[model samples]
Target: MGHVIVGVDEGPEAPTLIAVAAEMAQRHGAPLSAVTVGRDGAEQDGAPWLPDLLLRIREKHPQLQCAGFTLTGTPADEITEAASGARLLVIGSRGLSGISGIVRGSVSQAILEGTSSPVLVVPSRTTSDKHRASG
Candidate 1:
């Protein structure tokens, strides 16, 4: 079965996207793959975080079959390549506004345009949202 792939980044919305992807993978009985893209040798420190992030996600979702990958390239290109043959692709919305916001950020827009698989864009969670929900 094709995996459910999620594009992961250092942004605040990454965990939300990962959770959605993991849930989708569990529902579909497919493995979940998290892909993080950065320039070569530019972010080696960030590579170790993917596994830890996956482990944390697994704690909440024990049944999720999850793996993480770090790649060097354009975020959109790497994400598109990573989701090849996937059942679905999950990404976090960067909350870009104005006319350009019609497509969100460049990476999200590029992935939407280039990926063959279905894409799910999860909105970034904000402190205001938490307060609104609790209030």
Candidate 2:
């Protein structure tokens, strides 16, 4: 069975992306793979967090099969390659404004363009939402 693959980063939205992916995997009875990519020679904050994230997912869904991968390469390219033939690819959107998103470029957009797998993008919580959640 094709697995559900999730692109993970050490961003505030990572948990949301992971949770959505896990739920999809559970519903489909597919294994879950969490992947974080770093540029060659550059340190990635997400690299160190991948294992812990997988552990938490496993604990939360004890019957789910979960795996994590830390890779070095371009984020879009690596994620696309990893998601090849996957049942689904889950990613997070930072919810940047259109112009800002164009200026910054979006890994989710690039992956969407490059990969054949279906993608689910979880939107990031806005600043006010964060504050409200904390409040």
Which candidate gets the maximum lDDT versus the true structure? 2
**lDDT, candidates in the order shown:** 0.84, 0.88
The C-alpha TM-scores of every prediction are 0.82, 0.87
Per-residue CA lDDT of model 2 for 22-81, tens digit only, reads 999999999999998888889755577767777888888999999888889999999999
lDDT of 1 by residue, 1-135 (tens): 699999988767776778788889988989999999888568565566678779988998898789988889889999999898999999976656677776545678889999999999886778448657999
Q: Show where candidate 1 strays beyond 4 Å.
A: 40-43, 99-105, 127-135
- Could you say which candidate leads in TM-score? 2
Candidate 2 regions off by >4 Å? Answer: 43-46, 127-135
Q: What is the lDDT for 3 in model 2? A: 96
